[model samples]
Target: MRYLYSLLLLCSIVLWSSCRNDFETEPSTGNLQFSRDTVYLDTVFSNIGSSTYNLKVYNRSDDDITIPTIQLAGGESSNYRLNVDGLPGKSFENIDILAKDSIFVFIETTANIENFSNENQFLLTDAIEFDTGANQQKVELVTLIQDAVFLYPEKFDDGTTESLSFGFDEEGNEILIEGFFLDETELTFTNEKPYVIYGYAAVPGNRTLNIEAGARVHFHEASGIIVAQDGSLHVNGMLSNDQETLENEVIFESDRLEPDFSEIPGQWGAIWLTAGSTNNLINYATIKNATVGILTESNDGTSNPTLTINNSKIYNSSNAGLLARTGHVKGNNLVIGSAGQSSLSLSLGGQYNFTNCTFANYWTGSYRSLPTVLVQNYLETPEQIFVSDLIEANFNNCIIYGNENRELVLNERSEADFNARFENCLIRYNDFGFGSQGYDFDDETLFPGTIINVIPNFYNPQENEFMIDEESGANNLANPSTATNQDILGTPRGSSPDSGAYESIIFPEED
Candidate 1:
């Protein structure tokens, strides 16, 4: 009798479960609230995909409401895409929102450049339609797309990407690099539309790639410009009248034009000047979002500096802003900030001369082990430590300060001459309980009139603002003989100039 009762109870439970309506919802009223009336996506390159944006749909009434339809107004043939709640589609049906609750809708897009015709910017529009008939409601979608000069390596029939012939590995194996050489006829980058490069663009061995003033160059992930053996690169940028309109400054940065990525570090690879590349010069340029801003690899034989850069800013680098491994580099009125590692690294033995420059590394990324400025004359390998003579590492009228206790590090080896000097500079350095390897503040020859362990009082180093405040330790202390007459922004530095890349001034409204 007990077994018979159990069986009857199981059958009753199954019948009740099957009769329940899990998806029951009430019809929404004509009033539907949205987080925004119009969703404006950030500007994007024609063929590039945009970042995902979201919208909130609120059911303010005290009832579980069902939206009959949520869709793009362009129907099935729109450049935009939508994801209602959790499901992705051009249109959705029967989306339910609980009482006093909200559901999210995600939107993204990729438009074609041809549809834009000759217009500098094309406005693409669409709408998300909810319900139908008298209960219809909509939220508009808009985006401004720009035409770009896209250059990428060819894809093969086998679905493999193209690779350039890099020299060889230590074992004589051919090293193929994922890149392409620009056509000889199109070596010059003009001030037309922005250039979007997909991979490393190699300059031909004997050719030069000239980037004109106001030319904007964008590099995709892991992409950059590489100068081949004996090749040269010249960035001819002029100073702009308005500081805000850095219009004439040649800008090199990541392809993501969105404001959120402006100070994000390590978006692309370095502007690599290969071993034999020579006479690379850059002026009035702004290079940002690189693993290493400029990597000059061992152009040691030439008396002339491998790179001569002036009035330039290098920011948000993962590694060193200006890294010269056994090479020569000359810089003036340069500002480098927020590098994960050293902001100015003259490492593995190099010849460097920097005047009126700022190396302020307020790195917010992972913990940094190195200082803001590091001058090392040795490279340690697993097998052994190799020491090279650091011919000269001179910093005149400069500022090397950061969040670290020690912003300047000098690493030397007994076998090599690690010659370095600092003159009339404001350097942030504290003598640790454990001694600084080769630090001597009393030596006038090595450190002439240098201010130690003092705040340069940068406007805001964390935000990549290197301009010094009026009450800064760097004011009126520069060695004028070695300093640049003009600041990075083309502001004239008086005879008694402030140190670092910028001259302290009474700012606009502050005056």
Candidate 2:
């Protein structure tokens, strides 16, 4: 009888589970409906500048939404502008006319438009959520604004260092410099000339420069920085009066203005380190005022060169700080300043390492992907920075901080080997903690990846010990030998061990 009763109880439990009525019913949200979950624009223009093709936005749910404030991405806000007045509280608007209710958005800038580049980007935000026109609850919205085809003047030179300065006219035409290489091989420029690059300054042959550390390089008319397969930049540092060597500090700025806020790509390009590029080292440098900062990679990934960046700072560039393709990149002390519009972008699919690095993203206005490993880096619009799905990389002894809206996003399939460890670090942003991993993909996909492997015990900033979060590997990484010897400020952090790119400096205790 006892056995029969037990079997009956088991059967009852199964039957109850199978019945929908046996479980509590979730409250129906029938009134809520979204016009669209997301929207895209082929091109957009602000009072300052324009954007390139591929702009996108995210709708938090299936509900109506509105945008409150908007700004251009990168530093090109002087040419074009965005018109946000006609946009309904729940309706969206752009310069282009797209088929209503469709996900596809297409817009382009005119040739008459000014201050627009091929790399211009824009970001839009909506603070509060509201209901659709109906009785439904409103959904949140996030959008990327940009335009298609930010064109630049097509004039380039491949010769020895000369007094070359190029720029754009008031009508936005290319201004070329016709001169021979100077005897000193030093290209000096005056602010009177405003040159822009339609493409990039491609150094094909071997090149060397002895530039002043604080020299300003205004890339007003260059698409980006491309070191050809055979190119080489042996930027030797300068020795300061206090024994500080000359740091190669290159500032990238543009002529784009505000109102339309029109600046895009092809206005200023990225710095590409190609194959056969030898010993490209930069120290005590600051790379800012352009589209993308310093990048080391080949589009096909066959090039495997080495570059070292020590005691450097990269800030205010349009997108990432330091982007490494399939190569070897090492830095002793590096600081990456963030614009808060975008996080410090890193595509580490190669052998990359850092001794002491600091990444700061204090701005919390828009939502951006924090630096970590991720898959599917696709930015169809101005605000998005795409992650090239197939790459291997790591970040060590680094300090990563951001605001509440931003976060570090690591996809499920990406695997970062041991060299990708974040030892003695502090990462705090948004509603998330420093180190945690989640199951983002399932077995159905070819790649199953995770976001991070953090060692929580090591994250104690007060104790100055940091450990990468792992299922069980925290103990091994916490060894004292792994502590970074220096800080971003170029000071000794002490052997006692601190986390990330900073060390704790404790004075001697008084007796």
Candidate 3:
């Protein structure tokens, strides 16, 4: 009887608890709180899905509440999608929340910008609406969708990759490479849209890849543009009268649009110029965040320069900023900084001429062992060895400085002719323990009008600003004949120009 009474009492308690109306189902009191009033999905390419963003809907009242309707303003035809609780839909009804409890709403979008006629990008907006009786709560969603020409590696149905035929190896063997050649229709890039490259965009022999002003090119990881043998590349970026804006500058960077990745290094591969590629020119361009900014292979003994860079900047490279392997290069008003290795590397013998250029590497990412500038004449291998003559390497009105005491290094083999000169330039080198292995700046014939061991006083090294301040020792140090008439910003240099790529401009102080 005692066991039967206990079972009957337990049954009665269970029935009462099941039938109880403890949960409040009344309409909300028109008081709803949200974690954020707006959600920004950042920037994404057209027809590409964005990352998911979250919004929290909180109930601060003491009693439970139910939302009558929660829906997107655009209904079913909206580009944005949402997930409420564990259900994915555009609308929800009668969502219950306990006292002081919160629920998360996940939102994402893949905007179709085919109808957008803007030159650069379009703004996509939407709103999430919540209705509880006569009151309503809303959260605005915004995103910037950019239209771009997407380039990726081609994969065939048979699981094979597209391949191109380069010329040949030293033994006359055919060289097959892993890349696709661009057609004639895709050789030119205009300013109407940005380009997003996934694989190496190779320009075939006898073809030219031209990029107009204000054209932005974004590269994915380990992807870049490669000029094949007998090909050319022309980048015609110009600077407008407004020096503060990036309006007319052609930018080559990573595809990541996040702000945090703007300064990160090694985001992409190099702009590679293969052997026999000639007549390549890059003017008024900005290249950054790459493994190597510009790389040129061995020249084909042509008098034409392998690359001619003018009024350009290359920064934040994991390897050398400008790497030349037995190639010929000429640069004017060029600035390169923050390289993990040397800022300028002329290896395996090369002919280089730099005027009014700055090679500054203050890399703080790791302990750097090499100097800012490295010049070598020969490369050794176990099976064979090759040597070439460094015809001429002249630095005129240039600034070569870094955090280390010595910013220039020359490794010469006895068999090659190592000819280099520094004229009217500022260099950072202290000949304390560095013996005769280094070049002597005291020799006027080799180093004419060269200044040694002087502080450059750059405006800001941490921010990668290599411009000289007013109090810099390099002010008025360049000879007028050796310097370029115009600076990197298109500013005219006076009679006595300052060293480096930029001519110092004094700004008036405001009261």
Best by lDDT: 1
lDDT of each: 0.89, 0.43, 0.88
What lDDT tens digits, residue by residue, belong to model 2 across residues 134-154?
323432323344332222333
**Candidate 3 lDDT score relative to the true structure:** 0.88
TM-scores, each model vs. reference: 0.95, 0.44, 0.84
Candidate 1 structure, TM-score to reference: 0.95
| Two-way TM-score contest, 1 vs 2, winner | 1
Mind giving the per-residue lDDT tens digits that candidate 3 earns over 35-125?
8999898898888788788999999988889988889998998889999986799999988888889899999998878866555688989
Scored by Cα lDDT, where does model 1 land?
0.89
Per-candidate Cα RMSD to the true structure, in Å, reads 2.2, 20.6, 4.5
Tens-digit lDDT track of model 1 for 1-511: 9999999999999999999986677998877799999999889999899999999999998888898888888999999998888899999888899889999999999999687678767999899899988999989999989988888888999998888887798899989878899887669999898999988899988899999999999999989999988899999999988678789999999999888888899999989999989999999999999999998888737899989999999999998898888988999998988898999888688788999999999998899999999889988888788788899999999999999898898888888888999999999888766855647777899999898877787777788988877889999989877778888877788788888999997654545
Worst ten in a row by lDDT for model 3: 430-439
Q: On TM-score, who's better, 1 or 3?
A: 1
Clashing pairs in 3: none
Model 2: how far residue 266 lies from native, Å: 11
